[model samples]
Target: MFTTVRQQGWVDGSAAITGITPYASALECLMHYFREQQTICKKCCHVNYNHEAIQQCKLQKVDFIWVNRDLENFSWFLQLLNDFENEQLTYLETLRANNVTSKRYIDFHFYFTSLKSNNQGMIGYAPFDLAANIYQNVSNRDVLTKMRTKTILGRPQWSLLFAKFKAEHRRTSVFFTGKPVMGEDIKRWCDQYQFMYYHEPYF
Candidate 1:
């Protein structure tokens, strides 16, 4: 369904950020945006070629997850999460001493009491959502300036898009593995849409 190039891919948010400067720069501000929620907002769950790495944090009863073993992308983000019956078994220890820094971790509280899994993904509070959320929550001069000139990596093509009311769709989760693997070639595996890209993190 793609004219140019549409291939399913995976992102090691942690590893992927190292190359893109703008993304890396914006990431700091994004991190401050939620103390860690920024990755959930900006970094993680990116469209193809612009994907990010992974992370985890403890949030009351809910676990702030980011890493999905490759193959999961072929389906859908919410489906992978909804399929999660237990965090204890589903939790991926990709980051070894991450709890203290992100202040987030995995647990049993799913927080979807009255809501069903399918519809629960689309709720938002608008006006407040803009100020509180860092992902594309562009506003006055300060934030826009930081977005454009933060200088850590490169500039995000968000402010102008936000100004014009346009949106970027999450397409393929593309990322270069950048290294060689034993069994499948990263590029070839990505083309094939295999694990690390579409795997079952849980059962």
Candidate 2:
């Protein structure tokens, strides 16, 4: 829905993209952000997120994330953003509870089951992976092709080898939800890989 307008990014350029990253759509920008974890909106792009700069809109008054609308309901996608923000807060609280100071949560990695060090990354999910029939969850719930992140277990989905082409439409993703997974789904994925935690939780 937010991909209707041309989206652009001024970012920490990688070899694949250099200077003035103009995303084909908002979803593309999201994919790039998940992979790079770098700032995506330095020049007032259409889609803005927690990790981005202050755009024309004041920070306090704007939505947690801002994306241009295009007659499609983005409630599910907005939920994704909310989850991302909530997870960040939870991580910070976890770190504080685990004897890490608020000013230095970055230096200490709180050992927990299936907890990511940072929550800026992304992951794709099948419809059933999320809900029985997610049609009831989203305005545009027609299944589409599988959409993935930049890495296997590194960051989000894919880059060169695991890339999803033209990652906007989530109307035919029966193979996968073509959208990022959230909440308990993330724990399932992290536990499956044992990538984000130690075998024994540490204090």
**Per-prediction TM-score:** 0.19, 0.20
Model 1 compared with the native: what TM-score?
0.19
* Model 1 poorest ten-residue lDDT run: 147-156
Q: Report the Cα lDDT for residue 33, model 1.
A: 31
Candidate 1 whole-model C-alpha lDDT, 0 to 1: 0.27
Candidate 1 — which residues are off by over 4 angstroms? 1-20, 36-172, 177-184, 194-203
Model 1, 21-81: lDDT tens per residue?
Answer: 3322322333333332222336675312111222321112221212222322223333333
Best by TM-score: 2
Clashes of 2: 14
RMSD of candidate 2 to the truth, in angstroms, is: 21.1
Query: Where is model 2 more than 4 Å wrong at Cα?
Result: 1-72, 103-203
* CA lDDT, every model vs. true structure: 0.27, 0.26
